[model samples]
Target: MTHTIRNLSTLVELRSNEVEKLQSEVAAKESLRERHQKTLDKLTHLYESSGASGRLPMALALNCGDYKQGVMAMAAHQKVNLSMHEADMAVSQRALTAAYVKREVLGQVLEKHQHAAVTAQRSQERKQHDELATQLWYRGHK
Candidate 1:
C-alpha cells in the first residue's frame, strides 16, 4: 500500500510536469501564430499597393532591360507574396490545431488524475473501515 501511494504520487508529479510543458508549447505556438498573421497582413497591404501602382517601378528596379523581363520580375514578386500568404495560412491553421489538441490532451490528463485520486481515497477509506471492524470484533471477544 505504501509503495502504491508513492507510485501514484510520482505519477501525479510527472503528469503535472507534462502539463506545464504542453502549456508552454501552446503559448509559444500562439505567439508564432500572431507573428505570422502580422506578416501576412503586411504582405497583403504590399501586394494591394503594388497592384494599384501597376508594379512598373518594381519591374524597372529589377533591371529587366526589356518589357518581358520587367513583367517577369513583377510576376515573380507577386508569386512570392502569394506563396508567403499561403504559408502563413498553413502555419496559422497548424497553430490552431495544436492548441485544440493540447487542450484536449490536458483535459484527459486531468480527468485521469482526478479518477486516480478518488480511487486512492476510497481504497484508504475501505482499509480504515476494515481495521476498525476487526478491532471491534476482537474487543467483543475479549
Candidate 2:
C-alpha cells in the first residue's frame, strides 16, 4: 500500500490504539501481582503471630497448634500463588514493551511522511511563483 501522509497517519493511530490496550493489560497484571503479594504478606504475618501459648491446657494447646499449622499451610499456598502471578505479570510486561516499540516506530514514520509532504508542497509553490513572475516580467517588457 502507498504510504501517503493520510495512510501513514491511520497506521500510526492503529498502532497507538494497540499500544494503549497493551499498556492497560500490563497495568492490570501489575495491579493483580501487587494484590497477590499483599495477600502473601498478610499470610506471613498471620503465620508468625499464630504461635500457641506456652501454658495452655492440653486441649487448648492442641487446638492452637492445629490452627498454627493451618496458617502455615495457607501461607505456603499463598507464596506459590504469588509466584504464578509474578510470572504472568512478566509476560504481560514483555508484550507491552513490544507494542510500545511498534507504536513509536509507526509514529516516526508518520512524522517523516508529514515532513516530506510539506517540503514537496513548498517546492511546488515556489515553482509556481517563479513562473508567474516570469510571465509578468515578459508582459511588462513588451
Candidate 1 lands at a TM-score of 0.43
Per-residue accuracy of model 2 over 13-76 as CA lDDT, tens digit each: 8888988898888888888888888888887888688765568998888888888888789888
**Which candidate has the top score in TM-score?**
2
lDDT of 1 by residue, 1-142 (tens): 4555566566556666665666666576667656656665665554455443345587664543454445555656666665676676566666656656665665566567667878989999999999999999999999
lDDT scores of the candidates, listed in order = 0.63, 0.84
**CA error at residue 3 for candidate 2, angstroms:** 5.9
Model 1 stretches astray by more than 4 angstroms: 54-142
In TM-score terms, candidate 2 sits at 0.89
Off by over 4 Å in 2: 1-3
lDDT for 87 (candidate 2): 86
Residue 66, model 1: lDDT of 52
